[model samples]
Target: MNATPCIIKLSHISFAYPGSDVDVLNNLDLTLCQGEKIGLIAPNGSGKTTLFHTIMGLSQPRQGTIELLGKPMRTPKDFEAIRTQIGLLFQDADDQLFCPTVLDDVAFGPLNLGFSKEEAKNTALETIHELGLSGIRDSVTHRLSGGQKRLVALAAVLAMRPKALLLDEPTAGLDMDVKETLINILNSLDISMMIISHEFDFIHEVTHKIYSMENGKILTDEEVHVHQHEHVHRHGRHPHKH
Candidate 1:
């Protein structure tokens, strides 16, 4: 609701996976407001995925509180009740896609959420068609191309009609046309989002503000900008006045 200012709030959160010596997340604090789109930038092993897991309650934090969609999420049950409302697109398409076909994978979420078979099928079909994936609805999930797999993974998430989307490397291995279409689709959505990507340009274009994660913390930098140089230059050439 617009009345609720924060869609996600993690305060003083600290977490460490089982058998880990150190905390993957160390007193991290992050918030996503309603209708806000933000980007998370960090290298691999920087605990970006851990942070998302903590928010989703896949991994519980040893300390601190998590509030989602204006309510506290302290237990697995609490998080489960709202998980469908906040879609999480996993970084690995293989991890996300397990059903036999593209249509099955896409409709799985809605089915789990109590949509009738007809309703779920229709939703999946509409989502697939909208994403230009109609041709692959019957295609084998594990046999699709890398780019197609990524897009199908996204289609699965979008079919849930989440109020908030947590996308991890959604553009990885996508083609130029697919990337552009993804960008346009994301920009058109009126939902809260926190995208984690190493592609600076894609993040910059889709999110209103960008933050860099360091040492299990989100370093706020809303003014992140990327500049382009139009002039061409040759490799291994030095620049000097004639």
Candidate 2:
């Protein structure tokens, strides 16, 4: 079989926050193929979010290199042009949604990318429609339920038509129905995905591979068993890990 092209690459990467003694990520190397679905497993403070930030260009590494789409990454502008190619669903829905109305919030990405008002609105409308949020398009963003808010945030990223989607704790705090809905939505999307979640069962449902992280390093990368919902994690126990 031919080797697949990498959509994302990281080599010997390390990062440390200001005033912090420990590195959040240390000498980590990762490569993501064009359409792979990967579940990132790790405990809280295990550098999962830090890794996502580095990939999204929200933060810079103190050492080593990151390449997205075959080019070295530096600066917000380099990531800005690449932003439309990637969608990030932050763990906190409140942090992701800022505009007054759902339509405007969802349209933010396309509008900033220079799409006309009509085009932005139309794209946002289509995404919301796909996510079954048409009824809430004109509603105030802050007024939506937690699950609905997550959907709206997801729609905002989906509106950009990204090639890779990174979701942080997507199933966290969500009820079973909402979790199932989100799982179905993720399963239906065709793009590559890197999901960070403590919900092992849910991860098994939507992803084909697992990348386990511990102590600021990647421990294992393995294929998912189609019929297995439970994962034997080396990380500490969570609600679903029993």
Candidate 3:
């Protein structure tokens, strides 16, 4: 079988907001292969969201390169082409849902992408039904609970049929049951994903590879090992490797 190509690549990247001397990502190097479920863990203000913006082409780095699906990304239009292939779930659902009603909100992307009115509406309705949001399709978005709003947000993105997903704090305010539902949805999706979150339990349940970030720099990058099974002793004592 032919090998799948890398979906995201960042090389020696350095970035800082204008007028701010601090670099959010300093000479950062990161890559994601196709079908990989990766978790990015970092504290608040450690550049996790900044990295997402850079990857989404909402922001640019002061130095270095970023390539999405083998195409060099430098302009908004360039990012737009790749972005259609990548769905981003923002940390705040409110940030993503601007339409008055759920159906309208979910149809936003496809409509903007030049889908016919009928096509966009059908896509939105199908996604809403699949996400179990059909009952509330006409409801006002702000009136919904946090978890429900999150589902609606996810449905909106899925309606676009993105090839990859970048989710930021997907389960932030979700209760156990809703979180589990989200986990199941993540597991079932065929797209490549990169999730940013602080909830270790949530991240470990969804992703196989892990990257730790601190002060805008990556501290650890490796395949994830479940803490529960990783502490076992191989002999009379814990085995040490160097």
Candidate 2 local lDDT, 1-242, one digit each (tens): 96887888999899999989798999998888888999987778999999999998988888988899888887788887786787889999999999999999999998988899999999999999999999988999999999999999999999999889989999889999999899889999998999999878998889988888866777655433323344576675756534
CA lDDT of each prediction against the hidden true structure: 0.89, 0.88, 0.88
Write down the TM-score for model 1. 0.90
TM-score of candidate 3 on Cα atoms, chains taken together: 0.88
Q: Native-vs-model 1 lDDT? A: 0.89
Best by lDDT: 1
lDDT tens digits by residue: candidate 3, 85-188: 88999999999998999999999999988999999999999999988789999999999999999999999999999878999999998999999989988887
Order the candidates by lDDT, highest first: 1, 2, 3
User: What's the CA RMSD of model 3 in angstroms?
Assistant: 5.2
Tens digit per residue, CA lDDT, model 1, 61-127: 9899999988999778999898889989998999999999999999999999999999999999999
The residue pairs in collision within model 2 are: none
Model 2 misplacement above 4 A: 222-242
Name the lDDT value of residue 209 in candidate 2.
87
